[model samples]
Target: MFCCYESGFGKVNRFVALFARQSVVNEPPLGASDFKAAPLLQTHLLKHGQGGSGSAGSNFFRALALFGAGASGLLSCATIAYASDEAEHGLECPSYPWPHKGILSSYDHASIRRGHQVYQQVCASCHSMSLISYRDLVGVAYTEEETKAMAAEIEVVDGPNDEGEMFTRPGKLSDRFPQPYANEQAARFANGGAYPPDLSLITKARHDGQNYVFALLTGYRDPPAGVSVISASQALLCFVL
Candidate 1:
């Protein structure tokens, strides 16, 4: 029985190692240092077998324990490699002084107003803010009268009338922000086969999203030596803050 258990343990270890190697191969080529032995081992057992009560189960548990040491070594290596890459690239972002920085601080109304102006004059040309209506801006950025006036500048397509035809009318406070293009196909055609993403909720979608936007807008610089800048007819606009 002891000899049989030893054989089973060996088989399981070899199988786990083989499985781990395949997983490493399938992972996208991050540098060789990104993979650690422990994650591979843990991943192997997680993929292969659940805890059970027979000799087979005992062998699996024992194999998992043996793999644990190597797994820790692997995790440490991966963490070091990641830290080195970040250091080499200088990818850390600069912090912004947001108006609502502290717990007690209220939003900076003036800054919000300025940002709205920038979005209207620049971002609105290409990106849509479909989730926002003119009425949504009334209390925060503009007065009711101003919001209504702004909405009136755009012509919205209304329903089929008695003639069963779509008709156009001046936009209302209830209408969504007008899209720059009629549809996705038109947008892509106008933008060199690339569709611009909507700006609505963009700040909420990414990690440190607000700072990311601030960094991107202010981050444009000459490319490093030997790198070439490929200019498109319509450049995506976030690079100028």
Candidate 2:
């Protein structure tokens, strides 16, 4: 038997059972000699709350309703499960424009140059793009001499001397991007216990990488009514961005 709850109307566990009891499975087929079976089917159905004659049409419709309710419940459960999964993994940000490969769709070189400038001027103060080197920008964004010059502007830590002491030297094209903090502890201390994430591969790590970054950069606003605000430190980070 099926069970269903109806708000302000009590439980309805007996609906299916009642229908089953009045079902016409055991009844013989209607024939000239078996005219009494029709009345028997009607009598059985009437006992189950179906008023008047229990025609095949009425019984079929009742079954359909029961099936529909069960299916709806299953669908609702599946939807809830899907939503839970999304919440567990964190909600995805809205998609925005990204570079694509096609005849008309290509990386915006001008935008890339401007964005690189922004990263170097603003974001590099806290975040690190350690996976990339100055040499990686050649051809895609910068010329070989420009990339080498940019690398030379930074001082990088190098090998120990014969006396076993580390030394600093001009950064080379092969050297990884420099970091603002020496270690994780220093980073946390500088940011009030919040360690900035590395920006290398960030565009690939997020669901809608470019769009998510753009939204985060510009989406700082008062949350809607009933929305709980984030912690003060995180809120501060958002505003700073």
- Report lDDT per candidate: 0.70, 0.67
lDDT of 2 by residue, 135-208 (tens): 88888778899889999999988879899999999988999989989999999999999999999999788645
RMSD (CA, Å), each prediction: 12.8, 11.8
Determine which window of 10 residues in candidate 1 has minimal summed lDDT: 29-38
lDDT of 2 at 132: 90
Highest TM-score model number: 1
lDDT of 1 by residue, 40-69 (tens): 444444454433323353356556747754
| TM of each candidate vs. truth | 0.58, 0.56
User: What pairs collide in candidate 1?
Assistant: 36-74, 37-74, 38-71, 217-241
Per-residue error (Å), model 2, residue 199: 0.4
